[model samples]
Target: EPIVEEMRRFLDKGMELQRLVPFAEVMAELAWLGEGDRDEALHLIALAEGLAPTRAVFGGLAAWRRLLSPESDPGETDGMAEPHRLQLIGDWRAAAALWARMGAPFERALALLQGDEAAQREALDIFEALGARPVAQHVRGLLRQSGVSGIARGPRQATRANQAGLTQRQMEVLQLIERGFSNKKIAAHMAISPKTVDHHVSAVLGKLEAVSRGEAAAAARASGLV
Candidate 1:
């Protein structure tokens, strides 16, 4: 059966999604599907309503869930307050404008999808420019439905992960990490210093939106990137 169909039945049955699991584990799995499961995602977000006082995974997930759901209130985003405020108020054009100024191509494109015709076209351009094939395809479908043809599809020169915003160097570092290489070994293999390898690892973590090397490696593998 379709996962979404199964999930709907499961939710309807009132089955305990967290049986024998902690709230964090449940939230972790749901976070990846938040876009498709906004109702449960909102429930999970409510479980951790207040942002944790520190840099914790639960807090991060909660904030991300809030951002994905327009029904939810504005949440912190490492300090992108005004754009989020505009988003909360349903002003995607204004929010996207701020996102562009903030150099957040992903969020900007997402906001543009919510905006007017010109904004949607700009979003499509940004998605194509970023080599984000999947998102670009979705936006293309939307544009085509709106009777837009002759849109430039730019060169889709990169891998499927261009949407991930990871640099090539970071991708290499992540590959080595998945092979169980430590910093020193990765540095030796890459012909770079250990400190540099550490930097690359950190960048991989940030780009993957992972909290640790292990989680980043798991995400890379899950995405079939290695």
Candidate 2:
């Protein structure tokens, strides 16, 4: 059931791309089949044929036909065609490795298909450095399934403390602090008086339960508040 849900999510993302109809159609068929709904699978194949008149769709539909009828032509399963093969013949190893590190298969595959390997790797590295182990592990399993490999492991876990809420003004102040702006600089940038900036900073610290501005900034980052 988990695999089915995962495949459904993958198909959803593929459909979102709009241009990758062959991949999207194939995944849609796989999702329906995973759920043991043969009628729905055939319906999706017909939809795919309408959406993208390509050999991939024909191949996929043929595969489904064979599934529905065992004595169907053996020529239907001719493996991935040239274009689809070219699409798949990419840096899957690196993609898998990065996804493993990030602990997100769906995101990794999307990035790889979009040719955003560097961004994917950067995200994984950040996740590792921040000790997001559960996310990393989940990504690793996804990467393995996608044929990605050789990912490096880092810190396994990190404690995330709950953060106190801040008003919009306090949040603004914290963003400036994270930017290494002095109170005076923050005041100038925000068009507020220095004294007002100081007051907001103090309120931010108090509400966030932090003794220092740096701690407030770090807390905001961890909580995704900034």
Candidate 3:
């Protein structure tokens, strides 16, 4: 927790200096990453805004609050920062792509949850793989609400229970391969990029100990994995 301690010190210093932007930034981080409640965070953010009402210093943080707060208006993302604006306004696919480019995997998956069924499933897979059970369950609930079928009804199984460790997306790729779909076809079917499909295919082959797609499919069938 050294990082948290350092951030606390930074927050204290920002407050001491009465620096509007830094104070707002630290308050926002503490609000999200610390035990600070939503109301408290908003109050602190408002205090920072009061310091400089005309500045757009806390637009991203405000947008983040709106995105995470169920009661907040979704269309209140005007003049916010790029990815946060996209997320707050429900432009999730664009938000997801931006998060990916920013190397933020969790945020990317979260943005994906607001997309279509295919994207939601991909987000579920990422959450499960990351051991984020709460968010994964939330995603499952979303899928169910959307009438998507064949969703898992419980927590992720232990790693030892599924020795291959293939993610949900990878399993889908394996099933498609078993049904004789090429990587390009699988990508088209899954609504993902061809490069992503290639990655999934490669992961499936590695997990199944197969040198070729056919071999992987056969092994999956024989192992009752498909």
Top-down lDDT ranking: 3, 1, 2
In order, the Cα lDDT scores of the candidates are 0.63, 0.53, 0.66
What TM-score does model 2 achieve against the real structure?
0.28
- TM-scores for candidates 1 onward, in order: 0.41, 0.28, 0.45
What shift in Å separates residue 58 of candidate 1 from its native position after superposition? 11
Count of backbone clashes, every candidate in sequence: 0, 4, 0
**Would you list the clashing residue pairs of candidate 3?**
none
Candidate 2 lDDT for residue 84: 28
Q: Write the per-residue lDDT of candidate 1 for residues 6-98, one digit (tens) a residue.
A: 444465576353321244334333333221244555665555444344323343354355445536654444433666556655777788888
Indicate the residue-level lDDT of 22 in model 2.
47
**Per-residue CA lDDT of candidate 2, range 1-226, in tens?**
2343455557766653243344434544433223234555555555565665445545434444443444644242235443223224444455445555767654343334324445445556655556544344444544566666676654432322212434455667788898889999998898766755766677677656689989988877877767
**lDDT for residue 84 in candidate 1, whole number 0-100:** 59
Single out the weakest 10-residue window by summed lDDT for candidate 1.
27-36
